[model samples]
Target: MSSQKEKTSPFMAKAIEAALSAKSITSPNPWVGALLEHQGQIINVSSTKKYGAAHAEAQTLQGKHLPEGTLYTTLEPCVAFEGKRTEPCTQIIIKSGIKKVVIGIEDPDPRVKGRGIIQLREAGIEVQIGDGADEITRLLRPYIKHRQTGLPYVIAKFAASIDGKIATKTGASQWITGEKARDTAHHQRAWVDGILIGSGTAISDDPSLTARPKNLSPEQFTQPLRIVLDGSGKLPVNSKILQPTGTIIATSPKSEKNWQDSLTEQGAQIIICEPSQNGSGINLEQLLQVLGSRSILSLWVEGGSQILGSFFSQNLIDELWAFIAPIIIGGDGLSAISTTGTSTLAEVPHLREIVIEKLEQDFLIRGFTGNWAP
Candidate 1:
């Protein structure tokens, strides 16, 4: 169905591809470019490809002759920018004398949530917002979410063998996936705002918890916030995750004051929140809401199976990034995800099958997590 639509609407496909490529562009600006079409021909195309660079409208309008009234563009023009370089795009669209506005998707940034459409419509521009444009426009979700909510999109990473073991009987699980998968996982961290883990795993395994991208220089790693979901507040004093980046300890009131005080003295920020009934400490759901407040766009929960299982039980996980290792662990160990009670897919959230990328000796399977809506 999508193929047929793309076949008929070449402009949408090309614009979507451009938007996809623009995701890597840095800055306060979400990567956006404009393509001017006249009689089905893209006469001029401009993108905000670089930071402090020309914007989509500026690039498209640069000295290039424009046909009097060709359809404006496929991408919804960005109306407002808080950055120093530019003015609102709504004025540009208005000045363009464009009689029609065709927007792929509405902006998700809370600031401009629907203001672009409103501005265009107020100017009497014919606005068409959804013409097979959702998937393309959603590429801007992370950026808009970051701007509006001040946090990156949180995606939890997990791994397991065919038998659902994150590690072997000894829990000496290393290289569950090959270099390719591991590299991809690190890359995912680069895209996200931060990474999250449980204090239990932090104390038990003492993992570095920095989901670094491939080949990053030691200085470039700029590890994201290391979050430990320790309700009882029992993270080891010398756990290594606290040594490097900013460490946030989400604990409950029950956590020994001395333990929290010790963490505070060790250069850790302590957030004392209510614990859920399971008593994992710090309300996991509220913790995410707080991270959103702190501009931790995406939270990567990389932990032992039990930690992930708890998030699943708490219904806090939004997405799953799984690196399925080629090797098999036959021994009894933790499953990649352990639900709280005896539950099936039926009892819990609805999960959507997304895509799988084969990397090294493992398969990186990513999926959208939600309750079975159907």
Candidate 2:
């Protein structure tokens, strides 16, 4: 009985919930949701399931006859057959007897951008755009970013002390946050397409970096692609990362081929990138482009500070999620980012906090790159 633009609209809330269900499953294509209200009653609610499967609107039409009603979709339905998988969703909606359509946002992708809305309008269907835009945009941020710039959406994650240190000066960093925070981090890892860590982290922590947390069954979890930024291809042969299926070790061209070849034989994909501008590290932009070409839509970087600093320096981080433990280890510990040439307060990196919550003993702070606050 209500349009989708209202802040507290039930239709918008249900659509968002439906979209969230597709997390960890849909990549390359943003998660989408469709809800149909027929005769003042909710008839169908559907979400995009997989990459090549039926889209939300098409799924909603499954086994149901056309009925006069209003349709709500998190994104504008596609009108053109531009994708690799399914047919246009606008045709399905047009074939149905839906009287009105409310959309969250125009597709950031150029192919179906506003043409879907135009097609619906031309077909004598009432169309309302930009309903629940903020929530839907946040939900589709990774896809939107990838469509705009041919690179994966990057999120930098870290767990640090209250004084902003990831580890002590001796590099003894472990158990900074509680179990709940660690579980939360694991869940975050399960949501992204890839997980990245620096060689320093690989050597220091010797972590598996898989999404299998504690009692969670392997069938229930989706392990992200493991990526290591080892500048010289120095990942040890005994490292736990080699045990995984989709493991990539990115290094500079100057790295030794002997160890690289050995690791390649051990199930690691070696990506030899260009040297950095300073010639001390691998080029970060080039690494991102390589991952982008491989269809990595969203990436999370859990770091040992230096790799996180490189991404920060390049302004490549789209979001930052940190768990701040209420402990002080002020004895020359490693700072979150290794001092990025900010001399004055005006030059400090600014971030907008989107979520700050107390998860047991630690505080989880999630923010974006810009200064805008919610």
Candidate 3:
């Protein structure tokens, strides 16, 4: 039989994969996975589903006749929750007679920060922590930041030609990446609390901004909140964003009341925000604060250059995901970001812990920002 620590590596990978399987519906709650082993054989494998559904541990215990020997979880089992929609996961594990618990990472919720582990240990069950700590921490970065800072974790998604152009001189940027990369971008929409874009993208693209994929059914799809940062309240009345229930149109405090009233009548939440320090756009930090107050845990930004540039100039981006197509568009094409305040080589921004993957004809690059580019 493998020791608990020895099984951590493989178990962690399995658990992460399980977590990803539920990427579409797990929001406001961090994705979790659990594996149960009896003797030397695996008994159960599960991951969290929709919010308020059975959590990872509870799902693993379901239909198992309460049989368990050891449990491995990507996150600590939740000790308690405020609502009546679900029971405490810690109590469920204890009642199942699980002899041991191996946790990949601690729960970041201030309410359950290590409380679950403490509860299990006090029940005379052996508990271990720090298995696959680095990977698990990285996985839960958004959840951690949300709990600690009361802000949505920002992920900026960009797609550009091999030469770093996002669009042509005329701003025509359709079908830059292949089908596979586009599919992945749609998946990104399914995982986030909301999608944000500037009025420029919204007006020019007139995008529906919904998570509608060719292969998925409408009934099974989840649509993120469609957020448009319209400084001048210039959003078209017939725009598709206004058709969604969670549509938010943020404009500067100086916006006209008639425009506000008109949008409100069209099922849009009108948010008045302070203008940016540069006086040309809405304050990025203030907008994020508004989003955090609404309990939006993660925000995905799909841009048309200016929006991406604003976030970059303010140093507000937390993670970045970019898809680079195989072909170049030249300097005559539009750059992915403009006027980012990088004058010399020393000031360019650098990404830390970068990971790259080839997706069909495009390359996917993911990383965290270390600092603003010099």
What order do candidates take by lDDT, descending?
2, 3, 1
**Considering every candidate listed, which one attains the maximal TM-score?**
2
Model 3: how far residue 250 lies from native, Å: 1.1
Local distance difference test scores for all models? 0.67, 0.84, 0.82
> Cα-based RMSD of the predictions, in order?
4.5, 3.1, 3.6
What TM-score, to 2 decimals, does candidate 1 have? 0.78
* Model 1, span 1-374: residue lDDT tens: 02123221566556666555554443345656466777667776555665565667666666655535444444566666565466667777777776765666666666576888888899988787665454653455556556655644556787778666787777667757677777787766655556777765677678877766667654443356778888876788888878763688888888999999898888889888887766545666677678877756557788767678777776666678888876778857767776656647675555585888887567878887752110
Better-scoring candidate (TM-score), 1 or 2: 2
Candidate 3 per-residue C-alpha lDDT over 54-164 given as tens digits, one digit per residue, 9 for 90 to 100: 999898887665344778898988977576478889999888877788888778788898899999999988999887767666667777788878898899998999998
Off by over 4 Å in 2: 1-8, 213-221, 371-374
Identify the superior model by lDDT, candidate 1 or candidate 3.
Answer: 3
| Stretches of candidate 1 exceeding 4 Å from the true structure | 1-8, 22-33, 38-75, 78-86, 96-100, 109-111, 124-126, 137-153, 215-223, 257-267, 341-350, 372-374
Q: Estimate each model's TM-score.
A: 0.78, 0.93, 0.92
- Please write out the lDDT profile of model 2 over residues 1-374, one tens digit for every residue: 11244452578678878988787777767889888877767889999877788999898876767557788899989877644578788888888767799888888677887999999999889998777877887788888878777788899999999999999998988889999999989988888989999999999889999885665565544678999988876779889988865599999878898998888888899999998897767999999999998988889999878888888888888999989999998979999876457778997876774788899999999989952111
Off by over 4 Å in 3: 1-7, 63-68, 214-221, 371-374
